[model samples]
Target: MCTAYSSDCPPASSALHGGPAAPPAAVAAPVVSLREVSVVRRGRCILAVESFEAQSGEFVVVVGPNGAGKSTLLGVMNGFVRPAFFRPAFFRPGSGGPGNGRAEVLGCDMRSFGGWRVRKRVALVAQMVDVDARLPISVLETVMVGGYGRLGLWRRPGKALRELALSHLERTGIAHLAHRPFGQCSGGERQRAAIARALTQEPDILLLDEPTSALDWHAQRGILALVADIHAERRHTARPLTTVMVTHDLNALYHGGEGEARRTVPDRVVCMAEGRVTWSGPVADALDAERLTALYGTPIDIIRHGPRPVVLF
Candidate 1:
């Protein structure tokens, strides 16, 4: 299954070696877990037995080919990837013990938690962060929806909510564009607003789908920086917010590890292939050139650039 993206004509490791063993200290309860999970479409399994875990205040990334079920995996975590006709999504919450609710989230069964309840704990900022251009609301109001769960239905967003949303906008460095229509914002600004809206929910888990999706190099880098900054802030002061960032931008590396074997731990990378977790580990030790090439099915090289790794195929 190898392609033209291999680091050397022969890979350092075989294409199928999944990941390293879980360390002994890796016993802390995962904030989210998926076990032997599966999702079917057209009577065929699109995503099967894919699993990974994220603890409180951790950043996790999901990457795979277009149909590798990456999006489906994210949907399962947040309880969305519903079956069109045959199968159903499954998972456990980070706190639930075995057979209790391993496939749940935010202390509620994804199967039963109402929309508002889910909204309170998880906010999903999809790739398409566009608003109705004709709508007269300012950028500030647009991002305020993040507070809907807290403000509750039918209640007005009082001063506190406004401040929170505004603060997020400012933190995202887009406050000056607050009065602009959400539709008028550039790709990066829109994505930030979407993030701000999600933050308004004060969610414990932030699920971002390709925050850098269609942006250019500069835009993608900006969005990644904003996301990293946001997660760092959430870790420091937010309600133990655990962010699940779904992206294919391999440019953003982490502040973990030393030389060759030095890598990020706990905060691991989950590389998906055909709906399965093909690799998971601290970013540092997760993907060498051979692993990277196999994961992408191309002759890809993991080049050390600046403070991070860049992909060249």
Candidate 2:
């Protein structure tokens, strides 16, 4: 079921549709690059990255113990940290994207691109909604914040823009709550709203840090399923969006494809420990009992009974 696409993103050429299984190219350009990166705060080391790359349309799971610096890593990728030795480039480590800032994306360096342009191509959904829930803003208006990167100012969204936001809401199954106040909703509702906000940004790189940590089991699965769906659709788009998720939901080898249904199997798994990589390989292999037990300091078992991944801690 692995399909390919062309430069213009026209559903891969007709010839490539039914052709023999050609190997997937190396995908030279990385949407995110962290080179020799190290972050320290309050005399504590957070991120000590040797190297890492997030390819186009790839789903990357960052897992580790509570203090593994997962959040700090996401912040650096989104340009919140200024790493002295960090050699980062959207396409390379020093390229250009939309504006004059150099941040190469979709296979180009972002160094020639600007922050405004870079924000257009990447959207970050924080782990928690720390803002006042008591704000009077309706859900629709809240979702509209995603468009701010593109709108660039106080300009309100037009009818078409509103429709697009609603469409995103419907796709996420939160359309009915559009009129509700932000803080009055349940945690799950707010989670979906955050996702809808990211969708409204319509970005290529979706960086999420611990998105499902606060939700119930069903809501966690729903959020992961939503992310899987979005990534699947990116397969046909020009930039071919990539999702970088920082999560503790270790249902290894379980991927739900774009609200379509859970995947019979996942593409791969990546595990981190002690601010360094412990093991990274295929999802099935990475999540084997031996490896996971070591990472979490507990006995672990992955059950294969359901369509979604289930792990017993």
**Tens-place lDDT digits, model 1, residues 52-112:** 6777678887766667777786687666763222122334345443332235454444444
Which window of ten consecutive residues has the lowest lDDT sum in model 2? 1-10
Q: What is the Å distance of residue 41 in model 2 from its true position?
A: 1.8
Local accuracy of candidate 2 as per-residue lDDT tens digits, 48-109:
66666776667777888888777777766665554434333422555633322222334433
Model 2, which residues run further than 4 Å from truth?
Answer: 1-27, 86-117, 130-133, 252-255, 258-261, 264-266, 303-310
**Local accuracy by lDDT, each model:** 0.66, 0.68
Q: Tell me model 1's lDDT, rounded to 2 decimals.
A: 0.66
**For residue 245, what is the lDDT in candidate 2?**
83
Ten-residue region with minimum lDDT total, candidate 1: 1-10
